[model samples]
Target: MSAARHPWWYDAVVYQVYVRSFADGLPTGEGKGDGIGDLPGITSRLPYLRDLGVDALWITPFYTSPQKDHGYDVADYRDVDPLFGTLADLDVLLETAHGLGLRVIVDLVPNHTSDQHAWFRAALAAGPGSPERARYLFRPGRGKDGAKPPNNWDSIFGGPAWTRVPDGEWYLHLFDTSQPDLDWRNPEVGDMFEEVLRFWLDRGVDGFRVDVAHGLYKEATLRDQVRPKKPKKSAESMVERVLNDEPMWDQPEVHEVYRRWRKVLDSYPGDRMAVAEAWTQTAASMAMFVRPDELHQAFNFGWLGTPWSAEAFADVITDSIAAVSAAASAPTWVLSNHDVERHPTRYGGGPVGLARGRAATLAMLALPGSAYLYQGEELGLEQVDVPPEARQDPSWFRTGQPGRDGCRVPLPWAGDAAPYGFGGPDGTQPWIPQPDDWAALTVAAQEADPASTLAFYRRALAARREVFAGADEETVASAEGDLLVVRRAGVTVVLNAGTTPVALPQGEVLISSAAVPGGLLPPDTAAWVR
Candidate 1:
């Protein structure tokens, strides 16, 4: 990590905001409605972000998109969509975030672009022989069968990875057919992506959260991916097709590209950082993206898919810390994002299970690394049930998978309102319907209740701010056993995984997840002290 890179990130707590479902500024009259949550709408919520003690905000891709994969399928890099507001709106957001002392990191999907993008469109219009087509990875059909694709690599959405272009040859799409993967092996492709980075950096944006960082490259030989033994019809199968398990990730060339980008970032002030999304299960593989010449940090997905257990979480966290130590960079933890089910849903749903979810949040923050908290997670929001007819994600539609619609529901801001204050002023219908229970746990309701999860998070975040204020990786200390304990600076965090209260060394209690008198911590509760 260069001293010139994003310093705000080292001791920061990042709040991941999924714009489409966060807060819709516009509303339609129908009971079931769809409207855009423009940049202005996000701007209006800066106060809420500040109150949450978030030093940084990581918004999912908001570039011009086709909505195929929410905003993951970017159609244009430079232009801002009319539905989501314009370039000027982004300028305002950056200014507002910086004014509030929050560093803004936008999602950058450099691995691919929506097939609807002008480059892809021109490639199709110019035919396979055109030089413009070479910008993307295109391969000819197999043998004499001109229609069949070159290889059988499956798409993350489903079906074949190769999409037959409107012309002759087929182009590679690691994800949905609408999203064609870029050819990172090509020098021009590298240059093109670098230009995109400069565009955002020039806009005064702090940094980027690289989407599918590992998928940027692939095996030079278009080999068939090893399919799962018992191929079930679930999202995991799609992942088996094309994800971090591939040999393409952490490719030598990818490191060179990152090194170049890191140098570019070093030229800026306040220090910029790039957080890579590596979807591997083990922390060992994750470290590759955060080495001295690679990404500043990579998503530690070990906890994301693991079963809910304190012991298991301890192992994952310990392994992640070891991985970061080996790479000379700290790890990053993400409980939930647009791609996975919310933590509240994953670790047993409903109010009774909230302690488990909060325990996970506390565990992540207590560790010595950059932590990512998904939007609405602080409110202990559960996943929304999406009817089949209401599903829009291509992954779900084409693959018949449940997809991530459950976790990407609209946020609940007002105490009692339609779509939970995610819609326009009257709280009308939003782009996605809020969960039935959202109104009860809405932000307004929680804001007024001291016992609500929102308040707990405020206290927890305040604690984090105090502990991490002047701390570093070396300042973090750990204690082993069923109850995982971490101490940073003067703050000691102890999480009780068992059902009974446990004794702690004599010290004043800074905060507790449960109202356990004295030093004992209730089941699934956490406590912090000096």
Candidate 2:
């Protein structure tokens, strides 16, 4: 929290734009882009986001890659992939977005490089003990005949983290095989990333949304990860993973990297900053990423994963506030992202899930800090069950389980049919097919209805803007039995998580997630009063 010179992020609402599925830039007959979202697509949609009242937008990776894990596996750190658009297109997007009075943050993936990257290619060409191989985690296999991997670590995508090359040496990929982990112990890797940071900052971008911020470094000793000793409870799996002390995640050396990168950000004007996607086990561990000498903010996934209960959300929020307060930083809240199922579907499906998700969002927005909104949640979009043949997420291939394709479906903008105004007028079919049932979820339809989820979000954001204009980080939660109530900076936020109706507090109501009948808030409803 080395006080970002531009403090607009103090309570900013950032919208996450899933580039490939958001809106396609290709015209009806375009060949290269097919039907994927690109820079131009985003530039075309800036007015929509601005009108939606978000302070900034964070786009997922669009850099050059093999698309093995989509754009997360980077082959070139400097250029935009042709599937997305060109550099000139991105430059235009930055200009247009800034003109609309909205900030932009692009994703930065530094944890690993695509195996097709020049460095990795050179590593393969060169023999063992070569300088090129030193850039990535290349280790000799263990056991007889060098058939076994170096350790028992598993990839986040599935399977072993180590992949054996023809040369008898094994390389580490914490994710898909195409994404090989970089050796951060090497100073050259650090120097190369510094250049990458300066490249984007010089392009007039506002900041970066760092991908895998906690994964840049691994234990130098290549130690085995600690496993759960007892029969693991599904309820405790997340906490177990966090405190498991995994050797490859949340390493101390990762902080040193951010400390240096923070200096690069501080050097630029316009309040340049970075937000870490560090999925640390707890708020205390997560807060470590945003200390005085490090990055500005880290996503609080604990708040996002909490179940539907006043006690659950309250406990997480209390811990988050207490931890961030100690570090003199603000905690960020988010309900959905490109990786997880949409909250509307996770909160329970259909109408009940959507209502609970809306109420949860209202609760999060009412808190005194920054909040990140996934692209389609405002439209009450539920996860789509993409057909098996159409599924593309690598995790689906590695593990037979339903992958993240559900949440990555193309958004519907207009029209009553498939591809639904996705690419453009007469836009081609979406890369990941949009469902037929999404007809009513289109932005066009939502705009026509005053009671749509989009409408609720607009009013909620406006009210939130007023609540945090000059608000303090300090907050008080005086009511937390069945209903969750918090008083912050002269505003009171009450959420009815219980199963029955509750009396509304005495104040001028600013906004409500759902209709209030006879001054009584319905179950799974949230309201803000001042």
Candidate 3:
């Protein structure tokens, strides 16, 4: 596709802002004084984002919620949570971001809602067999005396997916019990979400990052999931194992939801779009969410799940591009998000990890599509070891696992101390504490040092805009040993994942993840050559 024919989001570099941890506005009113990041905080940081060269920002959910699953369990679809600021605050944020030439995409959680949501409350109060209860997936218990759950499916977080209500009927919650899944089969449910889409579009937001896009529809039969004969070890394998033919996920019926959502997005101007956070086993299944008439993009998680190996990266990139291209859609690349461990930490923490992270990010940017960057990624922030008591992710409580709070720690902006300018000068503590040792990782500190990760990100993003923004072609050359070479728009990117130094192609050096000594690309480094 030509650059002119493509939408703004087609090759946009989107920055993901986990609102509650980005920056705290420190409002003295209501719950705003509790030191959580808010709309005003995001608005205040627009200049920084503009200078960073990101084309757009994808802010995580900030809607009204009890925050059981943070803001994912939204209580009110249209209003901003008081802890994050108000709806008016969001309007200013939108206006300011536009004025700064940055597009804004807010998260839309359509799969479920907070148990405190009015609909869920009504469904509970209205009891079984009522119209209100029909809006959600409420089914009668299976066993004698109606004491058992309707199905044997387990929650992604752990435990049974069904929660029995006081009236003896059970409601399905694929996540935390506080977040009950809605029945998308209900026409009213579909119509209501369409209105929700219009509400944000009319407010001048660019688009939405649809949460759990693969889960809007479930098998009508509601049968128990068939378990694998052998237990899967890794989380990715387990997810693939369970969801491969699971009754509740990646159903063909779910595509209809996006088909309707596409109409709502098309009704607005400014190239409005939506990206699906769908997790499927293969690139083909993931591509289904981004069909021409459906969502504009779907996250290519195959790339994210791949390890730090040239062969793994090459295979994923090839599969992802081929699948999404077949659908006539640009692939979306993401390294880090709110849900997983940061790439640097995952690559193997410390100096080696940071080096690999930079190289990986450079390679991702050189690809032929959109890239979503998590908030603190540019600063090369490693996942912190949050004290168990300080962890807020529901996964930690539901399961004995370490949880995602480490990646969600408050960002280090300017200070040398705890909170690290994440909040106001009053030293109000961030919701999750920032590590005191992050003094060197602060934006202010890194901005002064050219060798710093933040500096590298700025230079890399600027180069990406100047070189690859309008480039329509990407080709991955066969790997020569552990060095993976990719050519895009006349620029060649060489990534050396092996321990030995590798010879570079005869092209003028543009940028290197680390300084190249003696014209040889060192191990765990990537270079852009033109």
Per-residue error (Å), model 3, residue 499: 0.6
> Could you give candidate 2's per-residue lDDT for residues 1-530 as a string of tens digits?
22244388877999999999887874435443367888788898899999999999999998999999889999999999988888999999999999999999999999999988999999999979999999999999999988999988999989999999998999999999999999999999999999999999999888899989999899998978877777567875755655676888888888999899989999998888899999887788899999978999999999878888888888887888989988888879999999998998888899989999889898898887799999999999999999999999999999988899999998899889988888755556887888888888899999999999999899889878776665774687644678888888778888898899999989888888899888899998988888
Considering summed lDDT, which 10 consecutive residues are worst modelled in model 1? Answer: 26-35
Q: What is the lDDT of residue 145 in candidate 1?
A: 58
Judge candidate 1 at residue 444 and give its lDDT.
90
Off by over 4 Å in 2: 1-6, 27-33, 234-242, 424-427
lDDT by residue for model 3 over 1-530, one digit each (tens)?
A: 77778789999999999999898874774533466888899998999999999999999999999999999999999998888888899999999999999999999999999999999999999998999999999999987988999989999999999999888999999999999999999999999998899888999999999999999889998998877787778857855663655888999999999999898888878899999999877778988888889999999888788898888788778778889989998988999999999999999999999999999999988898999999999999988999988988998999978899999998888888978888877778888988879999999999999999989999999988888877887666546679878888898899999999988888888888998888899999999999
lDDT of 1 by residue, 353-376 (tens): 688788778767777768898998
Task: Quote each prediction's TM-score.
Answer: 0.91, 0.96, 0.97
lDDT of each: 0.77, 0.88, 0.90
Query: Model 2 residue 61 lDDT?
Result: 91
Candidate 1 lDDT (Cα, 0 to 1)? 0.77
Off by over 4 Å in 3: 29-33, 232-243
Q: By TM-score, highest first, what's the ranking?
A: 3, 2, 1
Ranking by lDDT: 3, 2, 1
Candidate 1 global TM-score: 0.91
